[model samples]
Target: MSESEKAARLSVFKTYKLFVGGKFPRSESGRVYEVTDSKGRWLANAPQSSRKDARDAVVAARKAFAGWSGATAYNRGQILYRVAEMLEGRRDQFVREVGDAEGLSKSKAGAVVDAAIDRWVWYAGWTDKIAQIVGGANPVAGPYFNLSSPEPTGVVAILAPQESSFLGLVSVVAPVIATGNTAVVVTSEASPLPALSLGEVLATSDLPGGVVNLLSGRTAEIATPLAAHQDVNAIDLAGAEEVLAKELEIAAADNLKRVRRPQPVDWAADPGTERLTSFLETKTVWHPAGGSGSSGAAY
Candidate 1:
């Protein structure tokens, strides 16, 4: 082995801790699952994330919702950008882990990792600005002046897409939090190692506690409870099967949570700014615009 390669091996990843309430802790259930590389070689132990664990995460997310959503848009934008900076700094480690788990060549893994990291930068740029595009004043048939603007739905539950593990996961989470919404992401089951690594990235990022929760377990197992949780304001079924998606949709209807169904995605196709629009609600405002008395100048 080359000198640098030997050093890398010596410093290979240890089993990571779950990020909950801005702290790294082992799963509340005290269970750990064996994570393996593509060739079936053991890599590390990932948290055997549980139902109780999921519920705990939900509590954290709900607790952080008010502050995260109420944070100034400009400040949120800057914090989101900090995540991109941290990810960029750790690109090599991510590429290595993704390559090992997905069995891709180093170059291919690097490209995928780079794309995922860049997606955050793109979303960060949108946090403060997309509001202007998605909301605006409209000329209504009324005497009072009228205006409209967007506000975030609180505490989103996300089923992160399985196909593009890191990128898809980040895509859903970034947009949800970018608009001041807190989230809990159910990470990819088969390839959850990357998700754990991502938790490490977030622990270092300047994000507030509970703003984003990462849980790696059966999506079917955990998603049902979250979908039905009355406190959860919205659901993004961006990665669930039709049956699972339908079930979530039905549960969401009980509280009328804003549900974004999974589309047949063509990865090459542009996801565009649709994600930003999903977390927003338009509120129309009106007030009297009458003129002051013209005779006041006589004084």
Candidate 2:
């Protein structure tokens, strides 16, 4: 090809931005940092999120929580299933991004992408059934009936795992939304492209805006404000280093936020109900039993 034809063949680069309030916005700080492949090759620039960005995410999540949590369990299941469908259609793109992010061979990356998609499906199936598994009637004396129900714990901030970017991210995030809680996710600092790309898929899916917010930046810088934010009800430090997790845990204590500390995880293993149950709060109601004509007091 001649130089003129070659110039016309130049590829258009993509600008990676934070997914906040279901919209792609540059960081409030208007700062960006270099994102490189695992081999140190320049890839793209990702927005370096700031404390203000973190707060914005919390506001978005909080705004989305009531509607999301109020939706029927079956409806949440349908939306999560839709997410899986969208991911399946974009399988190839995720395979490429995961491969570059983790320095994996194409075949290995394909397996990870498959696992992530399947993880979404797995969580989708649990949406309607989780309450049954965790909640039920309780045995009580004195002609009183008691029952327990699981409720969403409002806004949850999740730190996506550093190494297993796609699969680990899916693991932490899918369960949160599937169970009717909105999330503010901090993607893998070193490998955030896949997570950011996933945001596009979510936007197109039927999920409400702000149900899942994605932030790409220095993990510690973004996590600090989220951990301390009064609006955030829970935090999952899945990607934090030991010291950082401990510090964030302490910060979360200020408002008695539910904390899930970082732990060594096998992303390929079948994730049990632990993640689903972590962000749930059990609400038990007691009612006095009486005849149909009698007034019954409930508490």
Strongest candidate by TM-score: 2
lDDT tens string, model 1, 247-286?
A: 9899889898999999876543456888988988888889
Cα-based lDDT for every prediction: 0.83, 0.94
Give per-residue lDDT, candidate 1, residue 263. 86
- Top candidate, metric lDDT: 2
Q: Which tens-of-lDDT digit does each residue in 1-299 have in candidate 2?
A: 99899989969998988998999999999999999999999899999999999999999999999999999999999999999999999999999999999999999999999999998999999999998999999998666688999999989999999999899999999999988999999999999999999999999999999999999999999999999998899999999999999999999999999999999999999999899999999999998765544454443
The reply for model 2, stretches above 4 Å from the true place, is: 1-7, 290-299
Clashing pairs for predicted structure model 2, backbone only: none
Off-target runs (Cα >4 Å) in candidate 1 are 1-13, 267-269, 292-299
Judged by whole-model lDDT over C-alpha atoms, candidate 2 comes out at: 0.94
